[model samples]
Target: MNGLGYEKMEKYYLTNLNDLLLCMKKAINFINPEIEYHHQQVAYLSYKIGIQMGMLEEELKDLLIAAMLHDVGSIAFGEELEILNEGDRANAHAYAAYKLLEKFNQFAYVASIIKYHHLPWNHGSGRSFDNERVMDQSHIINLADKVVVRLNRNKPIINQVNRIKHYVSNNKGSLFADRVVDAFMEISEKESLWLYLAYYPDSINDIMEYILRDNRLTVDDVVSLTDIFARIIDFRSPFTAMHSAGVAAAAVEIARHAGFSSNECKMMKIAGNLHDLGKLKTPKEILEKNSSLSEEEYNIMKEHSFYTYMALKDVSGFEEITKWAAFHHEKMNGNGYPFHLKAEMLPIGARVMAVADIFTAITEDRPYRKGMAKNDALKVIIDKTNDGDISKYISTILIKYFDEVVSMREKAADKAIKTYKSFTEQMKISQEDVFAMVAEKSES
Candidate 1:
């Protein structure tokens, strides 16, 4: 039986999780340099394994997402998510994924499968944990995640086949569910699976296109996914916790004020939400540094805008929006970062994004400084525009509707602060409780 608890994540993607999946997966992988493409590999392996095990169509879909995001808890919660059980810290990320995933209505059941991907089969004890039935799909991902992590990247994939198979055989009843291992063995002998891993990154485009080819998405899908990225980006520090929300809100207003169509405004929001996508890869030391950044650190941080461009440029529907978001750092006379594009190249949307980003940055308080008052903020922006540092057309519109646009930014920032507080408050687990839960699992 599909556990009663596991069946409800059926609407997880609201049609297709591929809506903005490319950007989301790429950003998640950026958290650690060592695990590049880790999410994609896990997703592919899990998809093939689920198919071999005869999982239903929807279940396989859910399985694919869970695998791709299996490690998200590690990225989603940082400062506040402490793993007190140092001996069993590996389970911490999985547990964190559970906490975050369960909060989303559509994605809740998917949480049931992921919360225990690191849990062992233990000769059958793992089928249920803490008196709740664990989904079999969890076992499928358990086997897939294990195999990928153990893969020796240096050696040829074909050569490691036997060793991997032998390892799976040895642990069958103890470390993995017997049925799950048997299903993996059936697919493991296939030449295609090995070829996919052997020639990775090169095979990435083909695999991603094949998997996402039939996806049906709407604007809401893109918004939901991008909001997830925004939270991961903004939640990094309280000083800038609501920065993306403010930019997104302010950009939409600027776009609307500039006579952008309704659809264009929504796209503007998507771009605003993702403008800092590359910041995910920047070092935390640079992101949360209290004082002015060192010249070397500033240069390193400059790469974030380019990285953001790279992440979104390849996404299918994000063509125009990608430039708008990525170019938020470029200047009118060609002095801005990562790219030094002159005024002649940037479009109105790109120009609007640039000014909106500045508006949010100046009005938002930081550890070392206070946000400017309305008049002060306007003067600074107007001065920059006059000096050819920003867009004249866009800044003029902003100056004309100063109260309206700035008020919109403030409202967005206020909403984001509420979210940040809720997120942090929800995640505040004490050391004693965390250790107790781990201890309970060990003895189960």
Candidate 2:
């Protein structure tokens, strides 16, 4: 709450805009598998819509980013419940996302669009409707977000179109604006466009290609991107934010201290960030269950690593990353599920991931149990190694850098909290600013 005006606050953040976007996207994927593809559909559809509307390139790009991140606040919803269909969830993740982004100077416009991307057009009671307030980037994103989700996940093509029509007709003067509805209708009427967006929702390179083609970033961008991804993935569960990052930091430090090459350490980092991507498919009830699970629930939990493998193993450069990240469940003595890969069959990266996974799990708080003290957590990992369940090299390395790993994770988490606080402050600045800025940004 620095009393920094919204205008000034909007202009000062996002030094690494592309990296931030990429990270936010990965977070989106971690929260909802359906949303991963949905975000891309929104971005691509918004781009095509922008072209049709004769907008500038920068405007289109921003709209694309906003579209991709529209439901990002849903990450804060804690868990993905089976009964909470896309339409049934009610935490107003959009508002939460707006507040989060409002804090960071770089994302003011982006945040604005996210906050009310679902509102209806032209229903205001004789209010001043400037570009920012009624027709900016947020509007475009809002329209695209609705159109894309309906097109992809709701029902069959004909059913989806009809559903959209009904939704628009019912909410015409309430949640959605008139022009936004028009855009949604235009998209729905075009069967080919809808089909194309629905089918090719995302390729392996969807996020990578988007950033590279749009922003011209490269592999060196991984550090910042991974940091952002870890944050978002953790956001999927209040109990898990930064869990991937913490594991990555601990694993990397352990690997480096244990005489692995910088490249191997880098690989460990990637694996750590993605180790839990499969959890997206899990229902919140299971994820947050405090008591022990039923046999069926336990079996379902055992398959997360397999899901992670299925999602990433086919990417060109991600094979190793996939194997390592997915192998977190493998036991050294040939007793893990989904693939009983024993120690000799497991690569060094897999070994590191296993250690990192355990280390972070014990060190982090969970609904079922309190986090162990740092030394105690390290001792458990060490004892596991003694039992031949983990690599001694990785375990010994963990003990060596245990302090630094925990310290860095705490720092990253603290930074995210501060960022979210800043965003919340910005959202409360003025109601007029919210409506005006969100609309104009949507239009652009």
Candidate 3:
């Protein structure tokens, strides 16, 4: 290992922790544009409150990450909006988020916060695990979450402040910790706070930069973090469980054949893994459809790449990765989606990614059909090349090394599948169990 604790021979890519968190928040919220800034609002409120409560900087950092990702579990259910609005139904997602995060040692504390984000503050008795009290930070998140849900962005901040205060005040002792409530009450007194929350979406990013300015993550750390999100993006549907992994593997192989430097290859692999980050917003029904999609469904699918671009475009170190990943669907003739750049405008990395994407899709099984035979898949790709959709050179390379590329894709996908199963199987409580608890709680 080198000074960064990554393998010495491998090239590492680094990104700002706050920038990465913002990208992830955007990707997660892309599930519904109506709720695109919901996580940010919650995180912003939680951070303001944490500052008022005089939390240690490290504690605030943890709280900020937990708050931003608190609702990630809701993605597992089809009725995500319903799950978020209905207190009873939402707990399942919270538990899901907890199970998902706890598996990573670095995120265990954040997992604990997410696990009980919905739990009320009727003292320590309201939520416990193995007879331990839920962390106080969870209560702060709960308060921030509830406050944001009540906000009506269309209304003026002054018009909504009294109503919001009333709601929080009424639930203060029973639903939120007294200290947390006091902190919120202190911060809520400022008119600027409400203005920031209700009107200024960009301010959240500014706050995050101020808060995380001193902390820097190495390239290896960012890669590990992106890997977590890659799982979240692909694991949303079984048909796509290994899609990103396969693309990353194939892209790396193609880049190697194209004689990309080691660092460039590594960056290409990361881009390929995250190329589908916007798919998190695509509905599962659309993704799992066995037959060809209607034009409307296909249109929705095309937006995934656009969404990927929007999410990653702002990350300081991801300019190349963003273009490579988001431009995969673009064609040489300028017939691609979200953006319509012609061959002269497209970069080599983007062209390689486009080829890798098509190759992986044809070889991978979908919910409705079996994967194509090698010769047949190759023919389809060659036909596309002839039609000016992708690069003929890359297509030729894939065909020449078909078996080796396929083997690499398969190995990478298998490892991804194992990781997915491990995450699902390690959860001690099932979604059904969470549903039962919600039902039991509702009855009482």
What are the per-model C-alpha RMSD values against the true structure?
7.4, 9.0, 4.2
Tens-place lDDT per residue, model 2, 1-444, is: 122132243233212445445545554565566666767777777766666667776666656667777666666544442212333232256666665455554456777777656544546521223434634566666556655555544445655767767866676544555555566566657777656677765542354355435443222344444554455556656556556767777677766666666555666677777788777667667777878899999988887888777666654445667788899889788877679988898887788888878877787666557779976886798789888888887777778777876776566556655654554454345344544544533222
Ranking of all predicted structures according to TM-score, beginning with the best and ending with the worst? 3, 1, 2
State which candidate, 1 or 2, has the greater TM-score: 1
Question: Each model's TM-score, in the order given?
Answer: 0.83, 0.68, 0.84
* Local accuracy of candidate 3 as per-residue lDDT tens digits, 189-252: 8999988887775577777788778655655565566677777788787788889989999998
Candidate 1 per-residue C-alpha lDDT over 1-444 given as tens digits, one digit per residue, 9 for 90 to 100: 112132254343223445466667678667764444666676777788888888877787678768777777767666344322224554666766776566555567778888888777888988997799999888888887778766776777888889989888888987789999998899998878976865563354455556556776555666765776787788776767888989999999988888886667777898898899888888888888988899999988899999899888877666787899999999999999878999888877889999999999999877678899988998999899989989888898999998899889889888888887876654555223445555654321
Ranking by lDDT: 3, 1, 2
Give me the runs in candidate 2 sitting further than 4 Å from their true place: 1-45, 79-91, 98-116, 119-135, 145-220, 261-267, 373-379, 400-444
Name the runs in model 3 displaced over 4 angstroms: 1-13, 76-83, 99-108, 126-128, 131-133, 152-173, 188-192, 281-285, 296-300, 332-344, 418-444
Worst 10 residues of 1 by lDDT: 1-10
Candidate 1 vs candidate 3: which has greater lDDT? 3
Best by TM-score: 3
